[model samples]
Target: MGSQSEVMHCYEQIAPLTERMLVLARAKQWGELPRLEGQCSSMVERLKDIEPLSTLDEAQSARKYVLLGRISANSSEIVGMIMPQLSKLVGVMKSLDRQRSLHKAYGQPDDAYLP
Candidate 1:
């Protein structure tokens, strides 16, 4: 809360390009990703010297709650921000679960995942 503007400014500077990198990653254009990665890495390096984020001290917690309220109130951007990673993790977990179930049903873990 001490410098909410600073926090938001940093996020603003990096989020667009990070999102672009995510898009290029999804499209599998690995060759074109370096520029975005460099931008993100540069922003991160700038940020690294900052102190860690605060724990939920009352005033800071209240600020965070307000921020979360704004995020939750606006469904589209929050979901867009979160869903791609969520979907990928879900897909990987489901695949692993299916492999597990197959192993349970058929008795061999290796065979369950094998062609």
Candidate 2:
């Protein structure tokens, strides 16, 4: 594990990214979500690497608890916002796949079969 400071710093970094992700999700800015999520994931990976050996002071533990709660809340809200959009996208992809399969089976170009 890293020192208390290192662990705390990772949490601090993750907090704001999660907040931004929530904001982006709320605004329906889907394109930016993955970029911010990737950044947050990297910070979490760093924490995982350094967390095993570190011990937090009382104050640091309290702050860590707060930050984690905030992160969780933000993540939950983001997921709530994204799930509907993801479902719609999955449906569209499945529709496209079915169309492609039908086209292949009948040897028809997609445009020829369009209504």
Candidate 3:
């Protein structure tokens, strides 16, 4: 929980994180996405605890809109790039699981021949 000013400052922080997320996705750093996502979730939760901001001037309001738009665009692009890879990874994992199950049912040792 923080003051209104601090919450507004968080909005500023979110834009850069969104940019970093975009960069990470572009670089295929799938392992890092969850960490950044956790950070984003924390910030959003902080923002949620506070009341809506009503003191922003026109210029600040416009800037907020632009930053939010950028964040949205970055998120969309990241999802687009990651979804296919995620699908493929899931398929591979499912195949491995099926193979393991079949091996268990056959009760064959690791090096045993199976017909």
- Considering every candidate listed, which one attains the maximal TM-score? 2
The lDDT per prediction is 0.59, 0.90, 0.81
Ranking by TM-score: 2, 3, 1
Candidate 2 residue lDDT tens string, 9-92: 999999999998888888898899889899999989988888887989899999999999999999999889899999999999
| Candidate 1 local lDDT, 9-108, one digit each (tens) | 4445566665566566566555666786677567667545442552335764566556545434443443464578679989999998888887888888
Tens digit of lDDT per residue, candidate 3, span 1-115? 3465666677888888989999999999889989998898888887777637536667767887887898899889988999999999999999877777888788966445435
Cα misplacement distance, residue 40 of candidate 3 (Å): 1.1
Question: Which candidate number maximizes lDDT?
Answer: 2
Off by over 4 Å in 2: 110-115
Identify the runs in model 1 with alpha carbons over 4 angstroms from their true place: 1-4, 51-115
Could you estimate the TM-score for every candidate?
0.39, 0.91, 0.82
Clashes (candidate 2): 1
